[model samples]
Target chain A: AQSVTQLDSQVPVFEEAPVELRCNYSSSVSVYLFWYVQYPNQGLQLLLKYLSGSTLVESINGFEAEFNKSQTSFHLRKPSVHISDTAEYFCAVSERNFNKFYFGSGTKLNVKP
Target chain B: DAGITQSPRHKVTETGTPVTLRCHQTENHRYMYWYRQDPGHGLRLIHYSYGVKDTDKGEVSDGYSVSRSKTEDFLLTLESATSSQTSVYFCAIRVLAGGLNTGELFFGEGSRLTVL
Candidate 1:
């Protein structure tokens, strides 16, 4: 079985400041990781994913996450965040087969001005 | 976009009343899933359908049922709604374009159900 854990429930950062959301997972087999963001009153959207190769993966919107195998972590980071980045972020994990995903509790990121 | 839509974007019902949510997709994807979102719990899968008439229970399948009679339509039903069941529900489809297994998923706008 696979499970994800998001260390933070909420993170408040000033606009243009760097932010990091920690995520850890437990799985016996190789896994695929993903980060999703949900805006107010909307469904989740894929922010980035790590299927294979290159431990680092990035999204189009300046968000990136690195897959650390030894630590079993896939933490999301952004050098600079904007007010528009305020949203709930979720971390998910699945086996290499990608049959289903196990998600974390979620972390609410509030980028203030 | 995947052209996925959920019906009854918002609904209010009483306890013990039966509620059904519909998910429709135009892309004719092979997999459809139903998930519920709560404050602390990110998203918990309720039920999923692999094909027409082929449905399976997810982590939180109790008190929930699903039906899929067509390729593009999946319906989730609550036998008897409860207060705990009041949450936002989302629908997702797995994309397998051109025989490539990208493991990408597209989500619907979501349906908010309030059980009192």
Candidate 2:
């Protein structure tokens, strides 16, 4: 079974400041990584995903994540964040065979104005 | 939008009562899943269906049961609701592209159940 670990439970940052959310997974086999964001009183929405390729994956909203095989980590980063980016972000991992997805505890990104 | 709808968006029930939550999808997707979201536990899968009548248990399936009779409908049932079962439940469908699972999911608004 694969397990996802998100180191931070809450991250507070000022608007326009850079932010990073850490995610790590435990799996020996190849896996897929994903980030989902949930706004207040709504379901989660897919932020971005890493299937394969250059190890660097990005989303349309200026957020990017790097898949580091050695560290078994996929950390999401954004050079500058907005107030709208304030949401609970969840990190998920799925095996290459496309079984089930395991989600982390989630990190609440609070962007203050 | 994926056109996924979960019934009884908010419900208040008592322990020992039978509860059923329905997930309806307009798209005829082959896979549907049920997950429960908690404060610190994130989301935990309860059950998933690959095809009609073909369902499998997930990590936290001890007290939950699911049935899929049609591709557009997936039902989750709790024989006897408990206080611990009070949580927001989400239904998701896997997005397939190029005859392969894209590893992406479209989730419903979620059904909030409160067992008092």
Candidate closest to the true structure, highest TM-score: 2
Per-candidate local distance difference test = 0.93, 0.95
The C-alpha local distance difference test score for the whole of candidate 1 amounts to 0.93
* lDDT, residue A22, candidate 1: 98
Q: Per-residue lDDT for A40 in model 1?
A: 91
Question: What is candidate 1's DockQ?
Answer: 0.80
Per-prediction TM-score, please? 0.98, 0.98
- List the DockQ of the predictions in order: 0.80, 0.86
Residue pairs of candidate 1 with colliding backbone atoms: none
The TM-score that candidate 1 achieves is 0.98
The candidate 1 chain B region of ten consecutive residues with least summed lDDT is B97-106
Residues B1-116 of candidate 1: C-alpha lDDT, one tens digit per residue:
89999999999999999999999999889889999998888888888888999998889999999999999999999989999999999999988968987777789999999999
lDDT of 2 by residue, A32-54 (tens): 99999999889999999999998
The reply for model 2, stretches above 4 Å from the true place, is: none
DockQ of candidate 2 against the true complex: 0.86
TM-score of chain B of 1: 0.98
- Candidate 2 is scored at a TM of 0.98
Which stretches of model 1 miss by more than 4 angstroms? none
lDDT of 1 by residue, A1-113 (tens): 78899989999999999999999999999999999998998888889999989999999999999999999999999999999999999999978876787889999999999
